[model samples]
Target: MYGHDNKQFFGNNKLLLPEQPVHDDFLDTMEKVFHWSCIFGVFGSKRYISILWSALILASLVVIEYLAIWKVIRAVTGVARDTSGHRSITARLAGTIFYSISIMSLFVASKLWYYWRSNISLLWAKVERSVGVKVPADSTLKRRLYLVFGLMTFCSMFEHTVSMIASVGLDCPSSLLMKRYVLVSHGFLFMGQDYSEWFAMPLILISTLASLLWNFQDQLIVLISIGLTSRYYRLNGFVAKLCELEKHQTEFNKKSEALKVYTWRKIREAYVKQAMLVRRMDGALGGIVMLSCSCNFYFICLQMFLGITQGLSTDVMTGIYYVVSLAWLCTRVISVVLSASGVNTHSKTALKYLYTYETHCYNVEVGRLQDQLTKDYIALSGMGFFYLNKTILLQMAGAIITYELILIQFDGQGQIDTETTPSIHLNVTNI
Candidate 1:
């Protein structure tokens, strides 16, 4: 019989999360591809690629990002000197620098993960395994993973597609882009451009793959969080069950009494262990999150400024490219923040129902769970710099808008000064 000492009618206290409703085909494929691993500890040497392979992938990404920087520098120095849409090169250079930093952060994160793989894997296993702590095979987590990965993938490809079309439609052929932009062979940014069907084909393929890798880092955090969040959710359900059991008096024998205590203890232990694991992950991967956030915030502000400075008055092709690129960036940044914030949002959700539990069901286990949740302040932070949440997303948006406006004013003032201010020529006389 189910553990019930009280005759209380057991009402289900399942807390449904309305925020993350998603499709999971994407994750199923990735699990098969990565062989169910994210942390270095999880990746047994059984992957299609080995340590050497991972290192090469990282090295290739670094090389590609470097080429992007080099290409931007080259472009600024000479390429498109005659082009009317010259202001874009400056924004491109700035975006390249930030993009390079984001790429390096992922590389660093990978190395660190490998270095501490053992400890992380241990933590991961503990939080994931507990009695009555199973997420459904068809849970929304899988679907969510699929949805985000798909949306981001589509957006990246779409942005690149638009840019290529604009470039070609404008009559700027592959040879021109190759001469102008440093054909970075790999990376998150769509910097590669070639008119040749053969040359453009490789660039297009690489850009898509690079984009997937870029998104994978942040999405990996989301994946881990979802895993942890799901566990918490199941545990909370048991707590609700405990509360319901107390609401109505249920008769039980000595075995039932022990079951009640054991189940209660397991629930509390699971919550604590899960909470600690979250803190540990925050320390290890905080920098990766920080770098991603910084890169996204900076580019948003910069892009907005550039977008306004060079409006529709510019050629229709360039205008189209601007809008598509900005749309992709905004989508990427918002999804990452919301997905990450869900961990914090959902972790503490049990509190809402915990207070409503009948007093008879209240015990030391419930007390501790409630107390811990209330004070734990569980959230993914950037090394204690900033926490991820929906509120933070709004705050960042406000800051970026303010910054963008200021940048525009500065740019406009400089242009006005150049046009209105008279140049004075000084004649030097030999004295």
Candidate 2:
């Protein structure tokens, strides 16, 4: 349904790429991810968009996704309780908190999407028709989307492999111990010692996908911001060209004032419309913005605390995974924060052209545009809790440093040791 012109992405009843390639804009690419596999986005077929289908799919999803999260959280919380080491227990709880945030992000984001889908689509169409100017394809936004997707996919796969390897033995799986380790990772076979691969494996897969919900939500915000930024840029350029043209007009072309005034009025309207679109987007995606910030903040601190306290494993694969995961996590955080911050940057940039553009005939449109960009303060936020900008990066670092100092002071008293006591039992699972 997301394909261009409503064409099938998979054609001829074969699960193969189309004969011709499909070029995806940022919105299309993001929607395609959720449409195909995302728990929240996968709805029933057109044949089943009725009440019965909605209820059935939503109910099944609740059982498979929400119930699974509760089960996993309960299982991990149990492990954390039984664990001997203070730091280890704290880390387990931190992972559970991070997981809970992911679940909530999806729940809220899905609700927002369903309720605001029409509003969002209308905003997109308005962008296309803004100021009677066409929105050119934004190649840069598409590239960023691809880069983000590549980094996230690699990060998730690498983390999953390392967590699996660390939980199981260093040796390849051949015996019952390795098999049991897999099930125990999800808390299905251990404690009670009742092993059922069937139930556990499916839930594990669903849990893994749920983990990607955070990524999906993050990328969606980034791409949408970039998308709006691109449109604002085009609007700015169009206005600038008019300003320059007016500045150089000859006496014979003085009648063009009427045309320029009309154009300026349109530009003013476009700028206002763009700003309104930001607010609409905020309402749709804002609920999860706080979750995005919180989860990133929590996970970065947890990974750093563990790396500093325990140091990386001497085992080469484990050590590499630790370092790479930490670095990749930071990259993801920086990418997301910067992407949204650009929206604020570009929104204010029109003021530069408005002030500097030497128009012979100044009009009320310019003043309105200037005031709209200046005092309006167009930026994404965590549902008005905090704005998304470059400052967040520093704020996060400072908070982490302060938290780490406290944790390290406690570690000196053996809160979390570099070497574990034989009494300690840790579950090496995806954080």
TM-score: which candidate is best? 2
lDDT of each: 0.55, 0.59
Clash count, candidate 2 = 0
lDDT string, candidate 1, 1-431, tens digits: 43344423221322221122243332344444243323221223445556555554456546656755665666657764321122244433543564465356446555444634557765564445433332333356566666655666566656656655544445656666543322222211333343344544544444444455555566666665665566566666656665665666545466655655555666666677778878887887687787778766876665566557654555686576667767777877777777678779878878877889767555677777788789888788877999988899789988998887777778777732211111100000000
Question: Can you write out model 2's per-residue Cα lDDT over 1-431, one digit (the tens) per residue?
Answer: 12232122112422121122234365576555445434433332233444344344345445644433554465456743334332233433444554455557556756655654546765666455444432234557667766766676767666666656654547655665445444435442133344566655654555555556666667667667777778777777666655565565444244344544555666677777888888888777787687777777767766676666554444555555556667767877787789888888888877877887665567766777777778988888888988888898899889989998887888799765545321111212343
In model 2, which regions exceed 4 Å deviation? 1-27, 39-88, 134-147, 176-184, 187-189, 252-254, 359-361, 415-431
Model 1 misplacement above 4 A: 1-92, 112-119, 130-138, 170-209, 250-261, 415-431
True-structure RMSD, every candidate: 9.5, 9.7
Model 2 error, position 225 (Å): 1.7
Clashes of each: 14, 0
Clashing pairs in 2: none
Best by lDDT: 2
